[model samples]
Target chain A: MILTAAFFSAAIVAGTPLLFATLGEIITEKAGNLNLGVEGMMLMGAVMGFMVGLKTNSPFLAILAAAVAGGAGAFIYAFLTVTLRANQVVSGLTLTIFGTGFSGFIGKGLVGEIMTVDIRKFFAPVEVPLLSKIPIVGQVFFHQDMFVYLGYILAVLLGIYMYKTSKGLNLTAVGENPAAADVASISVSMYKYLHILLGGALCGLGGAYLSLVYVPAWQENITAGRGWIAVALVIFATWNPYKALFGSYLFGGLDIIGFRIQGSGLAVNQYFINMLPYLVTIIVLVTISFRKSKKNSPPAGLSVPYFREER
Target chain B: MKKQLSFLLVAALILSLVLAGCGGNKPAETPAEKDMVVGFIYVGPIGDGGYTFAHNEGRLHLEQELGVKTLYKENVAEEDQEVMNAVADMIDQGATVVFATSFGHMDGLEKASKEYPEVAFMHCSGFKMTENMGNYFGRMYQARYLSGIVAGLKTETNNIGYVGAFEIPEVVRGLNAFTLGVKSVNPEAVVNFKTTQTWYDPATEKEAAKALLDAGADVIAQHQDTAGPQQAAEEAGAFSIGYNTDMKAAAPGAYMTAPIWNWGPYYVTQVQAVIDGTWKAESYWGGMADEIVALAPLTELAPAEAAELIEAAKAKFISGETDVFVGPINDNEGNLKIAEGQKLTDEEMLSMDWYVEGVKK
Candidate 1:
């Protein structure tokens, strides 16, 4: 029972970044832009975040710098795909390659470098008063850092914003049919630019969350393909923020479960256990494709660049 | 329609050319045809300051000692087609001998050796070899034994954490050797292991070390390709024994000693063998006596008697007076692995799959 509680706790810790990145990409896709540069943006955010966070020793400042850097990283993809009218897939992939290389280059000196400051206390778990009396639920969910609570609030708030607000409907309209949205007087470029930047910022924050609250250290490729996992989670959840939250946590749990089960005196093959997450991803991707609905489908104008004059 | 067809053809041509260019990723450097060049493929970046860094140092030494130019491709993913492409590019650029580092590069190295029969291919830490291909690794377990002695004496908790990269034979051998050293000095000491199953992930390595520290481990030993574990030990104010290279700079306050690799001598020999037409298919496993594996300098935090113990052990190993795997060995589950008065053969040592007593694997 104690082991079960710790395993679940580890799940939430691993899933927080995925939730953040998925949320960012969902918002971006809803704005009619399929930005596949989440991995690159996350890497940029991770290095810059660690650099700023380590230098200032202030979590807030570090996160802000990471977000800004992530935003700046996405600005390149936005400019190429939105302004220059480049192929979205090509531009996004280039951004990933460029971002990955640039971040690695910048992080060259920081590799093997240790932090002088101890920022663990700042990002440490803050148990909720009175609610801590509960069993596994309280230990796993209620006893988390500000980033987790931020995830809860952000998920609920983003869900409401997507389904309830007039602006969100307008954004959805732009993704479904940009010409129709333009006819209805919604600025396509404005929405795309805003959401892309917003997505980049969130992805950056996710990266910061990884380097700050989770591991609280800096290293090259520290995101370790988590950004790519977020991309897959977005699809697995069918662009729903709530589903993304649950699915991301499940993956996070699986990541830790393999080690936990082995450590619990099982003679299981570690390789087969490690392959669980990717194997599950394939299953998720395949199952979701069998059922199609208006709500379940990807945005129509996702990878298509809006050309108002062509219409 | 004709103009549109021509445009499509031009686009296809441009696309193919661009794809071809991307496949060649290496810079189109036209070296003097007569210049003798050796190629190196690194799984991680050279700046990693651990595994790749150690190999890069050997490459630099090989260049200086042999007066030959060395070219390298860094950050090549061993599992990706990058390995094949990088090796092919090296061949195209007139490389005579290629050193492919990382176990994941095994299949690729084998394929490349068969394809480029004229080129001498050498792989690190792999078991595969061909007519012109060879695999070479040092007996790092000897140095690991010495470092373990330091950890056993230095640890007040008698609990040492080992952050292992994988559950492979090399790592298992190192773990057993280390446990033996620790037990020889401090019989009550026990080693716990946390495997990340990755070679160069810093964050995971740190997390494993932290978990060990949380479990009351006072000393951290690791086989990963980074300084993250060493740094983790530093942060936790615990002692560390790093692999591949010295952890003195990575964790000055926590560094005890490291089982380090000095690949320069072997690399020079390989290059000289190729030049002298004496290159052959052989599995090279040099030990402490060969200067291929040695312990780093003991830091101030290490036990005072560690220096003397290591000196005596080093001399014994050099003189074949001691074998780390000699007789009376028991697996971690308390099963006798090697019988009394038996010396473990190279095959048993190479394919070691069980943990020694005192190791929580």
Candidate 2:
């Protein structure tokens, strides 16, 4: 029982950052842009968030600064793809390169610096008396940092906004066929820019989670490809926001299982156990790709640079 | 168009003037000029707060004490061509002495050293070297042995965990020495080893440390850079030994004194040699006597008796009265690799690949 509780706790904390990144990428992909630069963007966000959090000693302001930095980065993608009609894939790759180099250069001076934040001191967890006392499910669902609860709420809200509203339908139509949506008097470009910026902001928040709440200190390459895993989860979820929440938890479980297995003295090879999550990702991708039925593929016009030419 | 052209012309003239001013202040050369420009190429971001952090601290010491002009490129990937390109760029920018600070940077440094024979090349933790190239590393095993003395005496479970970075000789030697040191005191202690191929992945390092703790190990030690293992040990209520630097602050309750490499003194010596026009290529493997390898202060958690034993061992090592790997030492396979009353030759120690007795392979 204790071990199960420990596993669930580890899952929730480990999954928070991935949940943020996946949900952010899902929104961007729905806007007809596939940003391969999520890794780079998250790295920039991590560094900038650490710098701000360390300097200001305020987690809230650090997250805000990170969101702005992320939005600024997304704006570069917006200009290249929306304004200049550059290849979205190429532009996203270049953005990642720029972000990695820029972050490393700026992070050089932050080595060995200690960072402190008091989010829990400012706002404590609210326990629901009966709900908090249940079994494994209750502890997993009810007892978590504020960010874990927020991630679930964001997923539900995003799902409602993507599928249940007229504005959501219009956004979906634009992603499927921007030219047809534009003919119907919808501003396809405007929706694209809006969703892209929103996605960028969420990614930045995810980065702040690393420095402010997760590791809560400065370390280079700290994200450790969590951003890339988030991007992979976007595809694994078939671009659905709600599924991403569960997918993030599954990845988190796989990650923590290696340690759990090693702790048990099961005589398993640590290398094979360490490679479990990555191996599962490959298996998941293969299963999704080889399914016999027609399923949720990406939007038809996604990654196609929009121009106002003859239909 | 005319305004733009005139602006371009003025900008070009000003840029050249600034460049000339920056380069024109070289002091008048004596017949025997004694100045050196050193370059460093790093494999990871220097702000990793672990391995790279320690190396960068060494570089800074070189600058402050020896007054050498230091240039460095951070986050250079381990690809051979990319490393060569960075080395060539540094050489073009006037690097007289270059230090490639990773095992993967060895071949590129060797090739570049051959291409530019006049330049001195020092590769860290690398075995291959030429006339103008030398490998330099401290006897980290000596310090690890000292730390293990504390682990052996302090542990209640008689089980120790080792989170290793690679299967390379340097790491293997550290593990073997640590296990031997532990067994010297406890006799019944067993070391559980886990190797995570990379040197700086904190998530994996942390998990490895936790796994070791879970498997009933009461004390943990690591060869990786980050304090992940230390943090894991603290969380798991187990004691830990740290590497590269003093990590007592990271895990106040769990930290045992760590084996640390003090590169500052070596950096000061090497840079001074370069500046005095007396630099020569030679492998340097210093230990406690020279202060190249020293132990961090024991944390409050270490037992009083254990601390005493560690101090005694450290004193013996510092006074040149003890050798950690003397015969009759048996390898892991139960074969006697060194004869009774015999110390290993320098060449034998350099290429050591086998674990000593009581170390799990």
Best candidate per TM-score, number? Answer: 2
- On DockQ, the leading prediction is 2
* Model 2 Cα lDDT, one tens digit per residue, B9-115: 57987998797567532332232245567788888766777677678888888888877777788777877887889888777777888888888888888888898
Write one digit per residue (lDDT tens) for candidate 2, span A1-311.
Answer: 22676576677667878888888888888889988777777777877887887788776787788888777788889877887678999988887777776566567687566455255233234454687789877777887767777888999999999999999888888888899899999998899999888888788778767755565555777777788888888877888888888888887777666556543547677577557666776776777667833347777778998888856
lDDT of 1 by residue, B271-336 (tens): 999988898878888899999998988888888988888888889988988689988988877888
lDDT of 2 at B357: 75
Docking class of 2: acceptable
Please give, for residues A136-239, the per-residue lDDT of candidate 1 as tens digits.
Answer: 79999988988888888888888898999999899899889999999999998888888899899889888878777665556677788888888878887888
Fnat values, candidates in order = 0.31, 0.39
Clashes found in each candidate (C-alpha, N, C closer than 3 A): 0, 0
